[model samples]
Target: MQYHYEFILATMAVLGILFLFTFFKTVLPIRRNRMFRWLLVAESVTLIFNVLSTWYNSSFGQVPLIVINTFDVLFFIGFVSRDFLFYCYIESLVQERAPAIRLPRFLVWTVVEVSLLLILTSPWSGIVYSINDSGYHIGRFYRLVLYTNAYSYLLFSIGIVLAAISRNVLARIERFSLIGACLILVVGNIMRMLYPTYLLMDSFYMISILVMYLSFQNPDLYIERKTGLLNQSAALSILQEFGKRETFSVFALVLDDFSENRRLYGVRQMDAGLRIIADYLRTRYPDCFIAYLEEGRFMLIARQVLPVTTMCRDFDRRLQEPWHDIHVSLYLTASYVAFCGPLQVERPDIFLNYVATALRRAEEENQLVVIDEQERQRADHDAKIRAAVDWAITNNTVEVYYQPLYGTKEQRIIGAEALSRIVDPELGMISPGEFIQVAERSGSITQLGEQVFEKVCAFLAHQDAVALGIEKINVNLSPIQCRDERMPERLLAIAGNHHIDLSRFKLEITESALADRNVLQNNMKRLQEQHAVFSLDDFGTGYSNLMRVLRFPFSDVKLDMSFVQAYFSRHNRLLPAIIDGFQSFGVQVTAEGVETREMARELTRLGCSILQGYYFSKPLPEKEFLAYVARTQHDPEHTIRF
Candidate 1:
């Protein structure tokens, strides 16, 4: 019996040393997680108590069973305390963000209250010990103590299950480790309960320590090193498995200016920005499966059909929001395609390919474009448009049409916006929207814009006498065309060569052009210095932020047709506010696409200086536009009708 005590002491001492080393190693890396550190402290205390109990039993003469039972109670308390710490550690691990200190407080207090109640009742009060003449003593309440120990182990086992369900990825892995420890505790307690005299069951506690050592040794097994939202490989495997199940909607959000950001800010700062974005996405869309797809791009998978438009808009807003001593300008676009058909259970790689195709199409169009089978067919249509664009560039198939901008009070044409018309001869006239996009994509817009500018300058020069009555001739500029460093100089040179006054020429830039503030500012400054006026065209069409409008230098602001159309609607308050806002900036306002007397009346009431639309006259060829201008000038009282 004495030899059994000595063996137990030696075994526990060795196990305690190993457990201490493992705890120190694991805790070093995760020192920031205060709960995990506390767990190690609790574990160390329990191991110390185990060693103390073994030593107290072996060194002393045959002690009373009651004294041994007191040590047994202390051992049980230590076990319970250690198990509670394990639960806390597991919960902390899975969260990975911040540990909930209150939860462990509640749990520990509850356990202490229960233990105090059992102690006050003194369940083993009268049956302290049974000593025979042989001096070998045994406690009468041994079975009751064994039952209490078993109950404690059962509580810990339930805790493991609870922790498993409550945690995130990191917490779940820690829960797994806790579950392993709990199982060993349960088995050891059960073995001791069945055979009270058995000291061999102490080996199971050593096994639990060994399991903890294995769990703590590998950092990769526990915490995600990058983005700190589970690692990419782990997420990919899970996503692959999930794809094998029911249908899900996958979204691939590609940040357009990620490379620009990387160049502007170093790689380290870029990574930090990505992590912040990841954390925001994870918190907001908890159910959505998200991962870093590549540099400046992320992939999201959802069990439900996510509102892609709303999500994309919200995400863009969030990324652009001011953060920590830095205000980032995020140029983000997201494209998503839902899977509900036979391809529901397709491989993740294949699904990702389809998503990539959709993203590419969206980026090409610079809009949130979806790629269904119908959209795929449009790709073929787009190819035809591309061919037309190619012909237009080489053969000068793009015809220049002029739209007259008439002054309501003056009853005369003040300017004309140069519009492009594509006549394929074979396919006839193509829609401007359809072909212009292709031209922009094919890099033909730079040449196309120059051609249009040259023609307008020449037409102005030839009609200088007749056009002197007109204040300015406005030529629309594509956002892509504005980026070219040579565009302003080239346009000024062409006007100078044609002997046309640059003051008589106004270049109309879209609201979208304001998105690139640096380019817009530089071009506007250079053009203004050349005595050319700048006008904001299609103002309310794309991302009409009031702040951006205030920043731009504009001689005129063209209120888009959508706002003009809405002027007659019940919510007409916005129209006046928009007009007043631009006018307040000392910018002249032009109401575009005015098709009704009511719209014209509304604009006139709001003090709109210039008006253009079907109400005046449709965009006409050069010869027809001249004739229309002549007729309008001659007949002041003629009410134009389409």
Candidate 2:
């Protein structure tokens, strides 16, 4: 008995030293987790009592059983309190909130503490111990005390398990850490039950230390590096767990132009901007978790309904506030989708996808749009458009239609622009704006553009090319095709094989196609060397101001339809300035979308030499365009007013 007492004292002393070391070591890293800190303090107190109990039992010949039982009850109380604190710590981690140490609200904590106090003070306290016949004190109610201890530990274990499952606080790695801790506790409890020894239970303390160590090992365990919020990887894990037990609504606010801003401001400045937004959100919604999904986008999940709406409005307002010394306007758009009731979303990825789709639709409409049933219908329409585009690629469904370009002075057919026309025999004709982007995204535009160019070249080789006195045929180049290095060589080879003059073919490239200046310059130089005239199509639509016109090697420039639409409006000053700027560069100007005879006369007064618009004809098929050109050749002064 004396030897057992000495061993227990020595073991308690070792545990006390280890606990102190762990407590000091964890304080700095986990200082924010007040609940965890309190748990460590409670654990230290429990170890101190165990040490005192061991000393009293060993020093005195007839030590009071009540004193030993009192220490046992206090130790058990400490264990339960620490276990509850562990659950609170997990809840804090998952919520990405700093844990606050608050007095227990439920009757459970009061009942346990009060029961412990009563058990320690009662006369029956000695029931846990008895004086043996050989003048030695021994634990008598070992089975009963063990059962009570097991029940108390079981309550703590169940609380932690419930917290873990309900809160979804643990990541995959954290979950494994938790499972390891539970395993150690289970093994320690089993050993205590079988051997009736306290030493075996102390072995599990090492596992708790390991669990703490593991928790701190993850660099982004608490905060994200990118946005200074909880990362998506962590937030998604928490959301997944939160979905299981409770009914909460989720709303996402995405920032627009995050990447462009990042590029403009540099990485450090962008991160600082993100941190500012994150901190603002954290201060406003203490319960909500924010994450940076991409450089220019953030995902915020909140429980409160009205607060989320208010939060989104606030976020947009803050984003719109101009950054110091930055000339760019802070244009931000946010789209939100809420999930409630029985339709619970377990996967964050799917929820995020829906949010992204809603955001894209909102941006397309260029307004603050809410995702409703109509938006879902729009999404369905988009999906069908995508499918149609895919079908067009596989089945070679896209066709090329010719529209004649007549000389204003000659009134005869000069050339034609080969326009892309997708004729779906089953679904009929789809809009160019609808499937053209899809074709570009799917990399089918390269193939489609080449096909159209080949067809235009083939038509020029036939007898129809000679009948109309076609001097040149204009073929519009897709931006994707313009990027291809082989495009100039391919066009030249096709012209040479057909015995067609390269000088007779005009290649129309949009202003958007000149985004990559180096690629554009190289391709333009190569094609220009082959005597193929280059025209800047839809010239003024993009960032093509007068300065761009001076830089680009264009033989002809087509003014955009928007400029022509407002030609006679109050903004008429810009049209003359644009034409003067192009004429100064010795570039022949073509006015697109000239509908009325008044608009055409105004354009001619503005010194626009070439005209192409509905006043002459809408885009016509090959035969109709040829006939229209023949009729126009006989009558140069014919005025068809729209």
Candidate 3:
């Protein structure tokens, strides 16, 4: 049979180009990329040996029997290994998306080993192929090996399809693309079995390689367009692999005033400046993995501990010099953070969070920040707390605790303040101060505040606070929530759902919330129309003034705990002066943090009509708060002594 070799040569040429590009240009040390490069190598070797076997077989007795046997055995070996390599490449893709789904290595390797054994002994046993003096002949077991390869392709397709269906991480297009690659190989296998003289399988290999390359191995997917460097996605993938298997170091570069520079230089010039920085890192540190995390953030990762002091000094000096080639000598201020560790963390997301936090600290302190073990632990704890906050808000499990307000003259509970709390199953009793800030930073405060308001209204609907001598309950509003123009409407809707009276609820606002006077005024007006009372909370701590206080229609003003403690410690005249100034405007004074009898008595004598502190009662759950209110009704002054 005369075999056509033109198509085989052409396909090999194309495969060679792809192999070179994948090896040299797109060598991202991610699992998928490495597996893809392996597939390319396997395919190229298979084609080269297939072409050699065809040539030697065509010469017949001209070539030595040893040469014929060697080329035929090598060709079969490459052929059998090609399907296993394809399976490995798909496994890499699946594992990347669903890291938990591990295909058993032993089962597949067992079949591959048996196939190789049959091929290795084929020259003597005639199990796979035989190169006699006449020509190369398919042995009795050649069909067996071909069928095994076909089944392997079928198994790979089935597994990829299942992974696509089960793992939401695998998109439909990606799953189908993987299955398509498998189907192409299967079809090529069938054609080779049917027409052995066509030499068509290599062409199919090229097509399959093209499909896999476009689907997963394309360099553009992992490169940032603006800076032409490895992107955030690539960095995360590499970091995830390294974090699992090896020790590494990460040097983070954050532009301190990226926004300011972009505004001054315009988008195009700033992007160009970023590209220049990326190029500098790439050229200066060829051994390091460079990634651009957009908005003037870049990362250089190395397998060993970087020379922190020297590298930072070099980068600092380079940054100090003005950038050339731009119309203006573009000046960029950057903050650098270096981290070296075994970093025994399982998830790369947490490590990336640590990097982000470290970058922020470096920018704030205007110095290089080398993260120590304590900082790493803190960052890990913060990530966990943030995740817990998310879980609480998402599950609507945020609890509300009430702290009772004591009227000086009445000497009983007048009202209570509702505080949000989360008791995580794993992390018990997270501090309100800690989780509240996390919620606010993560923009979950809106949902958190809404849940608290609903729970408070539910409490009012069921508990009968008025009968308990509690006139109103104070609910604090987050500044982020207050900024929303529809905050009043959302709160009212929640309250209205439970048929609670707004007049019985005093919405507390912080001094910081007053930064946006227009939004605050609008929200206050809308809520006030519903008979909601407004109070200035934590006053005399932030940027508080009588004028700012009077600007908003606050029916009550609460002195900050710090001021109360300071007055008790130093007998500060400013405390009484501020109290008198607030009282003169007919804004009722409520003193916070009256932690002792003396502080309480002095604050009461200072003409504060309302007193709230640990001395009276610490924040309590609903049942305890109601029980305390009931006790205060009888022995209002001595019910709960500090």
Candidate 4:
């Protein structure tokens, strides 16, 4: 019991030191905030009262009886007055618009004042706590005094929580801490009431105030240092509060070249520039709360939508004039993403993503601001595609279609091209070209590649390819997949697992992708060592002409149909020479889109050994393609007559 008293004294001392440390830790903020100062003084007074009451009661005869009694009375008054002081502090924290304070302000405080009047008169009736010549003794109704004050505050607190339930507009962490401290206070008081020998209510009430101060009262935790704007967490918290309203908009501004400017100006000078920018933003929208997100990103909360186009144009007009300070002068490009809401309250991050992505899309497209119906529609469409692709990948519903690639000289089917297609029960037949990029963007391209490859390999394994004279089945690997270091080996593993030889499958890489031979070149080389064949696909479409083609270690080049169409329209005789040149370089040439029998005959004469087009067969399902193979072998030359 003696050591327990020492611990109590020691804890109170530590609590005072904590308050002092927090006070100095955020000296500038505390200096500006008088209510916060009163909070500290009130807590300190209550702690001093507790320590004095403890000593007065214990050393009853050692000290003067009257002095001890006076300490006891001051202790009870301090204990009771703190509740009103804390209520004022809490009322200040609440925003004026909050519904909890809808009641007449003076009326609420008046009731608390009358309760204090009853508590103050308790000393006369000896109801709260009393001091006699014997010692300081707990009054008969001491628990009533503690509960009445606590429950009154508790009722006010509950009103605040319910009012702000839709969004945490209040000092949420402090509110939570207050609730927890109240619960503990109630529990501690009930236990002490059950056993009248113990005195725990004062210590527990001290805890209630201490919890709020430490958790939510610290400004440094939520205020940005350089700009003094609400920090990232505070900004988001307040934004959620604002989001609860019916109509609000956010201007998500990203200061372009932020890191570059930081590098040029140095950290300290950059901070000064940011403060200037933050101040400018505050001036522009004086009533709005501006939040400085990390690395030159800032968000503004506006209760109503503004003309985004006009505002952004002015932003550019002002910023383009050049920002000049003592140390740095530069032109800064800022991008804006704005969204008016009936926001997606369930998914708050998505609401932000919609706006932030518009800014990114605008900057990327070299536009000023791209927050229009089309941009939002694109985001929604992409979200649908992502969800569809995710479902296809999960359910293994991704279908592989086979288009037959034929040898011109052999006049029979030589290989089939495998393309993954998605025909969602709802989204009906999504083109791989469209969804493949979606997969890449969503970082599910690898899974998509593996899914397609598994189907292709399984199809090949199921085929009587040797009997059909089908030497290989060409598989298209997305450029994103090719960039993966393990993609080649991973694909080889898939083929090996399906008991399909690497030689029986050819992975097609776009000519544009192969231009950077310094790239996934090693991945291809590793695959080549394992006898996996590679082909340059859509050869003519890339920026680089024969230069990328010559260095590429492809077994062949699949000419794009565009060249065939061009040849037919323009009657370019050079197409024959191009084919011969490719063949001479030891890369086999294949003519794509060989629609007419005449085109096929001409390509054969031009030294192109293979032809692939809808003329032979459009991309067919697995069973249909196998039947096509049988039909092709029987009448290869006459399948499509000139």
Q: Candidates' TM-scores?
A: 0.48, 0.55, 0.68, 0.61
Q: Which of 3 and 4 is ahead in lDDT?
A: 3
TM for candidate 1 is 0.48
Instruction: List clash counts for every candidate, in order.
Output: 3, 1, 0, 0
Best by lDDT, which number?
Answer: 3
Regions more than 4 Å wrong, model 2: 1-297, 301-306, 320-357, 364-366, 425-427, 440-444, 463-466, 480-504, 634-642
lDDT, model 2, position 80: 51
Candidate 2 positional error at 577, Å:
2.4
| lDDT accuracy of residue 117 in candidate 3 | 92
The total of clashing pairs for model 4 equals 0
User: In candidate 4, what are the lDDT values of residues 555-601, reduced to their tens digit?
Assistant: 88888889777898885556877777777788898888888878878
C-alpha RMSD for every candidate: 20.3, 12.0, 6.7, 8.7
Each model's lDDT comes to: 0.64, 0.62, 0.83, 0.71
Q: Pick the winner on TM-score between candidates 1 and 3.
A: 3
Q: Which 10-residue window of candidate 3 scores lowest in summed lDDT? A: 633-642
Better of 1 and 3 by lDDT: 3
On residues 1-642, what C-alpha lDDT tens digit does candidate 3 reach at each position?
788886876787788788777877856777778778777877877888888888888888887899888888888888878777877777777765556665677877887889989999999998888876667788997988867865775586567658656757666778778778878877987898888789898899789889988877878888889888898778878887777655789888899877667766777888778878878989999989989887678899898778878888888899889776647568878889988877566556567778877887789789998878877877878878899999998898899999999988776789999999999998999998889878876788889989999999999999877787899999999889889998988888898899997998989998888877899999999999999999999998776699878999999999989888888889566888888988899999999998888888888888998999898889999999888888778765646442
Off by over 4 Å in 4: 3-239, 251-307, 311-337, 341-345, 356-378, 511-519, 538-545, 548-552, 559-584, 589-610, 636-638
Best by TM-score: 3
